[model samples]
Target: MQFANQTGGNDFTLQGLLNSADTSVPLFFAFLCIFLVTISGNVIILTVVTMDRSLQTPMYFFLSNLSFLEIWYTMTIVPKLLANLIIKSNNISFSGCMAQLFFFVTFGATECYLLLVMAYDRYLAICKPLYYSSLMDTSTCLQLVAGSWVTGVLTGLIPVLFISHLNFCASRHVNHFYCDIPPLLELSCSNIYLTEISIFILSLVVLFSCLLLTLVSYVFIVNSILQIKSNSSRNRTFSTCGAHLTVVLIYYGTMIFMYVRPHSSYSSDLKKFISVFYTVVTPGLNPIIYSLRNKEVKMSVKKIAHRVLPSGFKKTQKNVKSIF
Candidate 1:
């Protein structure tokens, strides 16, 4: 589409970056700091999972994968986003936009599935203690992780492939920090009915299926907790699942609010704000949330510290000593 009064590339002129309303130097610096922490936090979790022998269990295995996913998830958006916030021009090409969407979809799907697996694991441990070891064995764990990745990659790519084929000559500006499906849909120059239906169905299946599984798992877990005769054991059991529940609540709450609602509720600003919690904040905090609140992870950290600091770093070392 040529320019109206001017020359070529008028209607299809490449777009540029859009930053926060107060995209000042201070805000830029603040976001930069947040990004750094996100990276550093996930990295620390990854390192702990890798080096700490006590953390070689299925739970830690999932956590390690999660840390890795968060790293890649943030990397997909933060660099270009930060650059766009600071620079005068923040234009991402069509190919670049599609690539970002692809990755975002993948990581999003992976998180959904991983959380389901975590919930199921929790259920097994709490409700079926005798079967936990046999159920979440190495082969089973490997299959779940592998299936999460595969499903995420496929679902993420399918919509991207279908949507990108639509002509986007009308407008190129995306109002959010990165290229997302909803924002991208707003730019389509072709019929999006089929695409919308397909994505809607896919989203429902993935989100609802996982939500149902998690809910059922928690129900069983709660029942088991109630059955415990000892208050101390009950509290200890609750503590083990508390962090996972918190993370799940924050994640599903934001996601359901964002994507699972009607289009009438759609606001790019609101979407961007909500997106921060799940995409940015959640990843950054998951490691700390788990390790800080978890006895096992805390114990693992202590073991690592004590073992690494000198020799004979007994497991009895205080968690406070491991935080450093």
Candidate 2:
């Protein structure tokens, strides 16, 4: 496949996923469905969490933040991905590419920290139930959310700073779907030793550190659950944490494999496959996972659906009558 011109000094061409005519149509529609579902599902999660009085606890508050982040996180990449599928010679300006990279990394790191916070939240709730409310009060929850965002922004910014300054005299055709760090680094003509080391160190420090802490929190959580006398209560306590742990495992597993490895180990096909999982598949699946597993969220969703469907049907009926 012929790539875009290298003549445009500030533009990099992306060899997007499944550019073949036979697969493009099906892939585009599939991703469109996923994108729509991802957006609508997360929106429902946000609305339900906000409206449900019973879900006003610290756990649901963090969940709402997660839903909010998922919306923007999916938004950052999916639209461009859809466009790239249709528009074969997908070229992005240097600034636009950098912006996309920044937001993607920022959201990614924010998710890591947020998951850590959620794990810690569970730790407190299960291991120290008596002090849970006082320790994770409204003020403290807001501060934790704010800190995660701030930390993500800074983490994303530093990598972009290093990347933007690098000389891109090599070919401008990136062999991946979006502006990921690995592909962009591969395209750079400059000395990338420093850039690679810095990013690798950051990824290790940020991703693994969070992973380690989350594991420790879960260790304590499991121990606390085991100590409970009643089997039903023990199962109930473990149930509350099941969804978060599932999400954490899926998200962290894909991300660590993608970002933490050496540059020489990069495989274009493997990278693309992994990217689709975290970026498209995970976002679409997250709300479903959380809502399906949590009884309260299901009840809240049913309440919202009941409240919305009638009004929507009425509007459709009125429009039909006016047309007639």
lDDT of 2 by residue, 1-324 (tens): 223333355688889985478888789899999999889878877888888898888988998898899999999999999998776649889888899999999999998999899889989998898999899999999999999999999999988999888777547878889999988888877788999989999999999999999999999999998999999998886776676687788888999898887665666887898889999998888777765457787766666655768668656545433422
For model 1, residues 1-324, the per-residue Cα lDDT tens digits are 621221233322223233435654665676688788778767767777788777889888888888788889889977876676676446766677778889988998899999888888778877778988998999999999999999999989988888767776445667677887777777777788888778878887888888888988988898889899999988887876776788888888887776664364665667788887877778767777765556666666666677777555554464355553
Report the number of the highest-TM-score candidate.
2
Q: Which stretches of candidate 2 lie over 4 Å from their true place?
A: 1-9, 236-240, 305-324
How much is 314 displaced in model 1, in angstroms?
A: 15
Off by over 4 Å in 1: 1-23, 306-324
Each model's C-alpha lDDT? 0.75, 0.85
